[model samples]
Target: MTDGTDARPVQTRRNLGIDLLRGLSILFVILNHLGLRIPLKKTALADVLPPWFLSRLNYNGYEAVFVFFVISGFLIAGNALQRWGGLERIDLRAFYARRFARIVPCLLVLVAVLAVLHLMAVPDYTISRPGQSLPGAIWAVIGLHLNWYEGRTGYLPGNWDVLWSLSIEEVFYIGFPLICLLTRRRWLLVPLLVILALSMPWTHAALRGNEIWQEKAYLPGMSAIALGVLGALLAARSRTLPARTTALLGWLGTIGLMATTIDGAVMWHLLRDGYMLLLALSALCLLLACEQRQRRGDWHAWRGLDWLRSWGRLSYEIYLTHMFVVFAMVRLFKLAGGDLRLGFLWYLLALPLCWLLGAAVERWLSTPCERWLRAALLRAPAAADPRQPASVAAD
Candidate 1:
């Protein structure tokens, strides 16, 4: 189950439930993008479905990114805790190297591809107002501030704009290790995470009028990440809950996730712009259920959902590359004289292509590069950590 070269576990280390959520989240992202390109109209299905329900189904892409953020925090914290025994004791160099190895290559390739598209004047890949950007979109991508750049300079193309989430995520990953070391004591780490979680409302509130910042601000995203970290710590320390208890937690979490993720979710005064805490806590509930299953060694694949699990495992690849598929497919749909009535067919064709592209990238490029970089950058631990049996839901 271990990859001997890098000392990381192989696919068997993958947790099924976690992958399922990841898969679902990425799919939501794609669905949202598709809906935007060719919006759902008064179809037979839409007519039959409740208006709110249809609306929720259409615009969940933004919420799905928050789901991914929570997952990222959980995986990173859980992995570090398992490997190093404590966050304070983490090997900073090894952590940085592994993260860099996994993240940088794909990023560079994405930027390079964007450059080519910009040169060719591809409609959805070209930067907007390059003059105002001073250096260019590449600078924002490299600086891990794409979200901020967009906030200041208006939007980039669809493919590049998607990197905004990456900026938010990478910023956390970059700072996480240092924060862990700084707050070595468990008491301090616990409260710091708590404070961040509690600050979610204010964080979002602070960005009140600014539409972009209201949605993609750093503090708001970090609040969710903080909740995820807390969830990991909680799951790692607690004993497996009883079957009924786990089920209850799972149901509660699932409902919360759906509430937040579904477009036009019930609005509260304090959470007008975002629902960071609710989404994170909901995700945490599911994580707790998944963690319990992991501990009980019953984390087997749910039959008929293997495709979703694969998507979950490939979430990172799919997330980064899917916009390319979306843009191309939409263009083709338009060229083929497609209309909103044919949107479903477009999705049917385009989704598989997205999966195919993501899978190919993983198999041919990212996976190999990740392995090589980890082997080169991360030193095998002094004592091999026991093949970590569970609780790694993955990033």
Candidate 2:
């Protein structure tokens, strides 16, 4: 996407592989939450299923989110770099507008819905703290400090807890563009980002005993995004490599990503902090491979992943709203005598329902509001510049 900028690079179509990764990420999050509600130790499926299979299904949600951070960093940083050529020419107002449009509309809807649900006494929606009110929860989330608040006070109920990631991401973004803008040389960003990338594991090692470090620490997430930035930089320069070499790196990355999810390994225990860093690097490799394929005009070769493209397109909405599906399913399970075995079946039903809900939110609210807001913002006298073009789509 461009903002009528002369520096804008030639826009490419969305890569199916990125879409598929995003789709899988959201699906993993939903399934992970669903598995949490189900008492796996008491279920027949748990008994019959291989341990490896259960571990993969139940515990990989965080990994999927790691995928999202890298992907988001790659895309967002790539977009900014393309638009301004360097951060010096960047339009901070337009950049903020783009993000606000993409994120705020759906978030407002989510907050409103949850507030209503909390007031109605929906299970798992009630305020957890003695003195806290619904507006207290709402303001904390709106301020994007909910992660810190939760780390101190306790968790918000159910899906509201998902806002923690959003809080961390937005906080990171607050400094990302500024850092890029302030650096006098493009190469300087490497050292800056590298330090940020390493900060997570360092923090983890130093603060292993701290609950906030264990729970809502923001540096790890920033590290993942920074790694994506590094990946994007490498991808931009890798167009000269033979396709075969790039493809091999891509496959290796894919394998490494899958290997990180395995539960029974000594490697998992020994490399706990570095494990996520590896996942981010693998994601970067996959992204670089996709960039190579895009350059080769074969990025869309995988038609089987088209379904995932739809999921990826709506990933933001799905991520925010899927908890509603989770809460409802949990309530239904309770009404049905709380049978843990039935959770698998309920999870199946939730998948489509969450997709449908996300689709509707995108079609009716988020997409339109984003388009209108961007258009309006660009049209405003203060926002307009004849020297620059209109804003273009990012992905």
Candidate 3:
């Protein structure tokens, strides 16, 4: 009896739930990175928890990265679908231009800054040891080849280890649009999703007990992205749900996510693959439920979380810049002869520091770069009409 138009919104606001989740994920990432070298034997939590728990909990930063991938895929794919009708008609140039503008400039700046810092702080460090020059370190970072020497070199120069994730993202930035362009058939998407899901386990098994596996895990970690695309597709196809049902699903999804995290350690190796699948599903379900609830005017509104959401909005900048602050802290602690240990207190201190650095970089560096890039990309005549207006376009 109801018309299709009644089921959809005329305009949609930003989803606060996603913002909150992203913010929380970034916080976890900072904690994980900061705690990497903390002696687990010294901590009560580590003592009480099983090895499985420690491993899973310790690696939760990777999970946060996966969640970001999902959000990216969902947002990007949703936009692509709306503009191109299944990607067949996508404007590849504009897509690539936008992606390059958003990612490359900041990345280049970070690499340059790190390079300069490495030169100033440790003039002797190099990609090759004993006789090589510090410029080798700069070359490794700028070329995104840090991972190649990570195992042999012990540590990446100047906290550039985190750039591995950025490298994976860059690869995706180049490849994902091509994927969409090549596989425009709707039927192919589901199969492609299945392949991505299957490929992770296969690749993991193939690379097990290998350092290369750990370094390249980000590339095979496309399952979350696939889940996000699925969520967007579901949103496009389905109607809003009843308020009570939406609320129930939201709670269920949240519980599932927590359970997945807690149980992930216990289920490591044996159920790691299953855990990822379940986590992605739970996140997707939560997103769907939240979307429905928002439509039905039943979504939760947390004022304190707005700050977190704002951080999430600037997460890319934060993620890219935090390494510099962490490296400086590490050096300071070393100079003071202080033991590097992970504790709740360390997180309390580091989190704020990371946020402050992120804010400063975003305000001073990323924002201006973004503005310039946007202006450049939006300047061309073809770019302006990359897609037809929705009003005049046909479904």
Candidate 4:
């Protein structure tokens, strides 16, 4: 739905497949974080728990974030192409306004809260280094430099550490629109993005020894996003494939994705090096299936995945605030003499709490502020200018 302020014609019809994938990604991210923060090994049930399941949980967060990056590239690039009719006619101002509206509101609120908690000397929010002040942390986050900061120094606390992904994403986006506008030849853009996407694996291979570099490099994340752009471009051009073929691709992609995500032992250097790219390819395959379904008007097929769609709608908020829930639950467990059983209970409760907080932020704050600010920033198109079409101008 158009939020009236950004002047861009927003796609109102929700894609159930995209939502389902996004929802699944966010769930994977939460589970990964839980595995890290909670001492589940200390619990009585640890011995009985399947080792495979535990390994799967810990290994998938990076892949999930990879999915998210790809999806962002697909959706953002697709929208800009659709609105402007082509990259040659893209309106950078409108793009920035929409991005600002969608991203800034919730992000600023989260940063403010984190800063306050750090200032209050909360253990969970405490600075990781002696010289690094709260203001510096806040500045890095706002400036989208958290990834660089963490790579140079160590990590920030739980909530702040998550900003590394956000920083990488925003920085990539800062260049996305300009790059699109600069390239007059549309075909060249796809090939260029593909080249970058392919280069990502080599980049990762080059950084093999550095833990921080491997964990939070912009190149790796950007590579995923580039693959996403390639996916969108191909999907836009291709006709719907046979349902059986699409289904096979989807299943193969999903299985490969799951297998690769958990295989951190590096049984083979080639497979390990290519896994990130494979994960993006898997996501792309699924996205292609989703696109085909949309092309065929198969909305009824989404009946079972409604919860995924709901989670997808609130995915951003859940991602930003879930760390708070994790930190709180961890602190409470410590206060109560560190009962490991509480980890299970907290995990159960935290899921719903995250949904509630995210929904509240989206409804009461982010949505309204975006609507108002976008409206203020973007002006309606002038009817006299045929060259500057209504679709290209904001509101």
Report, for every candidate in turn, its global Cα lDDT versus the true structure: 0.76, 0.74, 0.62, 0.74
| lDDT against true structure, model 2 | 0.74
Q: Top TM-score: which candidate number?
A: 1
Best by lDDT: 1
A best-first ranking of the candidates according to their TM-score comes to: 1, 2, 4, 3
Candidate 3 accuracy as TM-score: 0.79
Model 2 residue 41 lDDT score: 42
Q: Write the per-residue lDDT of candidate 3 for residues 113-184, one digit (tens) a residue.
A: 666766566532223355334565556556655554454455564357677666555566567767766887
Model 2 TM: 0.91
lDDT of 4 by residue, 1-395 (tens): 34333345544455677778888888888878877877455455467886666657655787799888888877777666556656556678877877786688878988888888888998878896865778878888999988877766777888898888888888888888788878878787778898889987798888877787687888999998888777767776778888887788778777766666666455235576787787788888887777677667765754677766677777887898888887777777678787776566777787777778878876788667666666666753322221121111111
Per-residue lDDT tens digits for candidate 2, residues 125-167, read 8886865678878988999888777776777787788888888
TM-scores for all candidates?
Answer: 0.91, 0.91, 0.79, 0.89
Candidate 2 residue pairs that clash:
1-392, 1-393, 2-392, 3-391, 4-389, 4-390
Candidate 4 — which residues are off by over 4 angstroms?
A: 1-10, 39-48, 262-270, 301-304, 380-395
